[model samples]
Target chain A: MMKTSKIPILKLYNNLLISIQWELDDKTAMQFQEDLLKKIHETGATGVVIDLTSVDVIDSFIAKILGDCVNMSKLMGATVVLTGIQPAVAITLIELGIELEDIHTALDLEKGLELLKELED
Target chain B: MSLKISGIVEFIRMHRDEIMKDWIDRFNKADAQSISAESDQIDQAIAAEYVNILIEWSKNKEDEFSRKIHEFSKRIVQLDWPMDKIAQCLHTFEKILFAKLLEKQIPGDPLELLSEIEKVTSPVNREVFLQYTSSYERTINLQKMALQELSAPLIPVFDSITVMPLIGTIDTDRAKRIMENLLKGVVKYRSEVVLIDITGVPVVDTMVAHHIIQAAEAVRLVGAKSLLVGIRPEIAQTIVNLGIDLSQITTKNTLQKGIEAALEMTNRKIVSMGERR
Candidate 1:
């Protein structure tokens, strides 16, 4: 079940807006990282935005997965954008000591969609 | 054919106990009041009357079978069954015996006896079930206990051995762990001083204070002084309540101040004079 990673990619011009609906727990995060990386490499998308509205908790391992996904996308020539990060999530992220300096997070999904539209040009 | 009563009496005596024991068990245990200490006299009186009736009914004891049936009926009134099984056997025998004698006037209920048997057997089954559940609960409890024991962490020890004790809610388990880790840190580093910064620790009770004291003692044994940093006002209040003495140990409010104290102990102070302040 954890092998199935939800990386729904939509291409608009040069950019790809991916909505990750799958639960990115420790077990499934690696698969997601691999899947997103492979998709970005294959499609040659200039920019990517990930929607995280459904996700409730992001532990150390998942955070590390996110870190790797961002770094790998950089190598593949794309900017990774995160969306829908709640206040509680921010507190948990800080307590867990996950360095989210490199990845860009928007307030809501609408901002993420707008950013994707802007990045396409 | 000449009928002899003595031959009948002997045969009746042999099977008398087997038949009578069942009736008596059901009679007494069928209701709580039947066998209670308060109703003993009443039960004896009823039994005596039953014995007389049985004797009167079997007055014509010429046949061995008839005489034996009489004695069996008398024994049942006395509650002489060893177990429910023996009682059951007697009830079955009574049924057959009454049928054979063409005594339809006598009322014996096989259904009621069967119900009684089920009631008697149910407690044994319940006892077995209780035992199984208790064992299951104990196993689950033991697994949780084992998990807790295994998950107690090993704190990281540095080369310089700077113990940053963020001490709030120093429970017994944590206290013991802190003590052990601090001592381990002291010996492992072979350093002169350990900077224990309790900046985030809000409360320190007697037990928690004692743990810190023990850790300090262990550090001193390894020829190291533990400089505890960040004495919060709340912690100070708690310590005063317990009447503990912190006169010997060095304490400071900030990590920088603690560092300065350790430096002064070694007579190595950083002379950073501000330019034209």
Candidate 2:
């Protein structure tokens, strides 16, 4: 049996916050995607902020999953904001040719919430 | 053969002063302007050192000969002596030595005597040339480092606004550096907008434009907006003519205008105060 740990997602008011504190393997990233959508459904959240401050290396597959999660959450009526992307990761993603063009981004969780609030208004 | 070789060395040692005079006179005549600015005493001292190293080599003092040659070459390099002039100086000394040996009619084959003279002089020539090129390479490497340091600099001008002024041709290496600095500066300064000023860039070909676009995209990914500023008229013409799409990035004609736009994005403005009464 393969051991897989679930990334914790916290709910604050109508917003769901997920801070990835470690490197995410493909399995965990997919599991987080599903869990996030289900949590948004259960809590009826209108916004999501995914903080990737602690996550260092991201391959193309993980980037694609993150982009997909954003689009999927948008279809379910909750806006998603990716926050705290490291400079190295950003350069890597750009080099990998993944722009994540439609996804909203913020510098940190605080700004991510502000962006979410601005989107709501 | 051994006696003949020692005889040639003995012959060179016996007429050392004559060889020195002839070598110095020939060197000064060949490139008078190169050494004219320097005091004649320093020039004579360097020439004497050269002759002494050659004498030591002919005497079979290999250790002292190498040490003296190394120090002499370094000094010559520091004095900014041209390599060709040094080569000519060594050639003149060899010629003078051969002439003196032939005039005395030393008991040896002319070819053997000439080859012996060449053996003593050629090593010094090679060492000096090696030192000259290595010193030049050191200087070029230092200047390259200095240029890299000046290539990318991010200045945080106002709250939530930073400025990176690029001042040279954007090669792929420099472009990579600019992108890294722009992103790190944005995150460190918590800047919402960054203005990349390229006023000093001389040319903007397709490759440069592509690098700039990639940098701007990476900045966006790091959650900061990048504004391309300082677009001179020619750069604008090239950018448009190349059919590069810079529509995604906000651009301004000057850094001043870009700063204003950055202020607005951060929900601020510069209000001018009237003159004091």
Per-residue C-alpha lDDT of model 1 across residues B102-138, encoded as one tens digit per residue: 3323233645433433333233233333444555578
lDDT measured at residue A36 in model 1 versus the true structure, 0 to 100: 78
Local error of candidate 2 at A29, Å?
1.5
**lDDT by residue for model 2 (B28-134), tens:** 78767756655467778987787777667756577877887888889989988667766777778788889888898877788888998777677887889999999
Provide chain B's TM-score, model 1: 0.42
Q: For each candidate, give the interface RMSD after superposing the true interface residues on Cα.
A: 20.2, 0.6
Which pairs clash in the backbone of model 2?
Answer: none
Candidate 2 error regions (>4 Å): B1-8, B32-40, B58-65, B107-114, B274-277
Which CAPRI quality tier does the interface of model 2 achieve? Answer: high
By TM-score, how accurate is candidate 1? 0.31
* TM, every model: 0.31, 0.92
Task: Please provide, for model 2 over A1-121, each residue's C-alpha lDDT reduced to its tens digit, 9 standing for 90 to 100.
Answer: 6667899999999999999999999999999999999999999999999999998999999999999999999999999999999999999999989999978899999999999999999
Docking class of 1: incorrect
Compute the DockQ of candidate 2: 0.84
Q: What is the TM-score of candidate 2? A: 0.92
DockQ of each: 0.01, 0.84
- Pairs clashing within candidate 1: B8-B64, B12-B68, B20-B76
